[model samples]
Target: MAKRRREHLFIETDGQVYLVRDRGTLRFPRKGEELAFPTRAGGTMDFGDDVVRRLKPVLDHHPEEWYQRDALFDRDDVDGLVKRAIYNTMIRCVSEVVVSKGNRVLMVKATRGFSKGHWNLPGGFMDYGEGPEEGVLREAEEETGVRVVLDGPLNVYVSGFPGKPAYSLGFLFRGHATSEEFRPKADEIERVDWFTVDKALTLTRNPFAKWGLVDFFLQSPEARRALRVRRHGLWDGATRAVRPTVFLDRDGVINRGRKGYVRTPDAFEFLPGAIEGMRILQDAGWRLVLVTNQDMMGWKLVPDRQLHRIHEAMLATLRKEGVRLAEIYYCPHHVLSDCACRKPRPGMMLAAARDLGVDPRQAWMVGDKVLDLEFGRAFGCRVAWVGPKEWRDRFAKEAAEWHPDVVADGLLEAARAIAGRPEGPARGRGAGRGAGRARRRGTARS
Candidate 1:
């Protein structure tokens, strides 16, 4: 007769029911966690909220039933979507915006300014589980060097902006701060001060203002509460959790390697079918990242500028070949360097994911070397290896190291494997999870 813990909550937006599982902790099949068939199905899933309701009935039949949600429950697709919506609703996404006021409010600092001198309230990306009030307050204090208290309602706009496929969906708040406690976080703020609302409007070189901040704030109530976060279930809340963007590792997967270090631009080289493979994945809508380890800089084997030039050549070649990359993140440190940006460490890729708003779990990593594969797997990506079979056999000794979801010859074949298409014969390399390095490049520039 114990009460079932409630791990899920309901959020309703636009009259649609969305399920959110506040619990993200019922840890089991995390990214990179070994895949295993269920021996017994009974276990707790950390879905948010206080009560753990009976597992959704449909889930017993279809484990992936957590994906469909959002539609009139009366519709044919209603049930599954409802369940996913509910499951997703158990989680939440929150961001921040700051409203700095002096004797009178003037200009608001822009978080990411569009036009030159166009300013708005300063705020930043929120970490997981941080509340909106806490987020805004923290940002206000960090940006203005002032500690403020949230005094009102959360204003949200579900609208789109230019260059965006969807909307610049965001939330905002009004707050009060003391001049004594106000000091901007250095390097983030150019200057923090007060100006007349009219002076701000006129002095700013940029003309685009959704309307002056004062005029906008005047229209909304600071103290009045608005509609709370609406809840949806598995079927209704599904859209919020889109298939994630991927972060890829470069070097081994993109081109033949340079022994010792591909120190100069001339040393940079691409493997066969590499560019085409990248284009295929890009066209299929996957964000490609280049996570590389270049310890030569610490060893003075390569200068930072030389490395940049090499990357420039690499990118130009890709651009000419019609390959578009979301970004290329490199780690210039050695394992002993202890710098947070190196691989086998996950700092660089992790940082890139944070900046690009990508989910590591939804990401994929491919490489030829053991450390690269190990690093990617540890960082939450589904991993793949390219190269030889004996290499995998050698890898078996460290089988506890990393796991590859699939193995193929080179980049082209690997891309096919990710798309769920069986790979053709790997011309220069062998296949399987514990395979050899595909298109291995020497550490020396020949």
Candidate 2:
């Protein structure tokens, strides 16, 4: 019988050994086979020991089945395998999607694994060689026996196992399921049910569910329409470019603004009626987009991972209130930077217009500051200012200089004006080309 090939690396300090070999089990070393390079003890394995140096050359010539216990480092062999080694360690792919229909979303109750009895979105890891859209569709079908069509990406979560070398890149998609009734897989899921936005929040323990459903889709009316627009096939992913858009500011408009930076999710609280305003705009054929300046990232006040968490929390909170943002665009540059995407610069707006296939000239920008108005003007968009009396007074001084096309007390009023609601004072307000400043002068006084 042939002996199984194995590789070994010895550590003398604590009398521990490391081994790597091919096995059917994909987990780390078994009880008898511990191969982790780093151990609990602060012991460093030195390959330059005299005994290892003597056996180095012989070990290099042999197949890579096992490292000689006393082998020294071999530069050429190690160099050749670096690319292959690194490739083996990196794992990036979409895992699943949360499918929504109006205020309700499909959630499967877990029957096995560590999530036993807990509810989560219907999805699993994408198959090898499959695109994200395809994988999500397949997983949705396999897990819940329901067909769903992809709308677009909601968010990309970058995560990893505590001790694993590979990373998990999860793409959360917003989709509409074709069938409401589904039979859960006997092993993976106990049952499937449609949970309302509020119910899902109370029942779901999964963070992604909180991030994707509770914070995003439930609040977005346009997204809800996209999920159910099968009658006309408008959401067949082809004719989305012509949709109208409403660009929103992050601070002051969607959430409370402060003199200091909102550096964490704890500091991020929604302004009253912010979600309702977005929902109103979305129902009126306007896709809600968040275009914000997060200079905190560039100034190193917050890291990207931390910001990612904050955005996730924000989305989760908004979703809880039944608001769905079409997309979010953030410029991480500091004020000192000349980057185009920063507020008062049209870079982010232009990028969003191109990416979302929306007409920038027809879009409306809602913000509380002069920079927001400047950004809208630069993008050829009509602007709405939602500010307190002090800020409005300040903006009034600039009415003759350059002002927003409309001024509203808050985001809900601004949304009402954009939606042409009868209750809105700005309904029937029109800002002709080169006449926006003049219109603002009259509106500012009123």
Query: Candidate 1 deviates by what RMSD?
Result: 18.9
| lDDT (10s digit) by residue, model 2, range 348-442 | 65555434554443578898878787777655456888877787887776643445767888898888888893322232333222332221111
Q: How many residue pairs clash in each candidate?
A: 82, 13
Per residue, candidate 1 scores C-alpha lDDT tens digits across 252-272 of: 667667667677888778888
The Cα local distance difference test for each model comes to 0.50, 0.60
Rate residue 278 of model 1 by lDDT: 78
All candidates: CA RMSD (Å): 18.9, 21.7
Best model per lDDT: 2
Give the C-alpha lDDT of model 1.
0.50
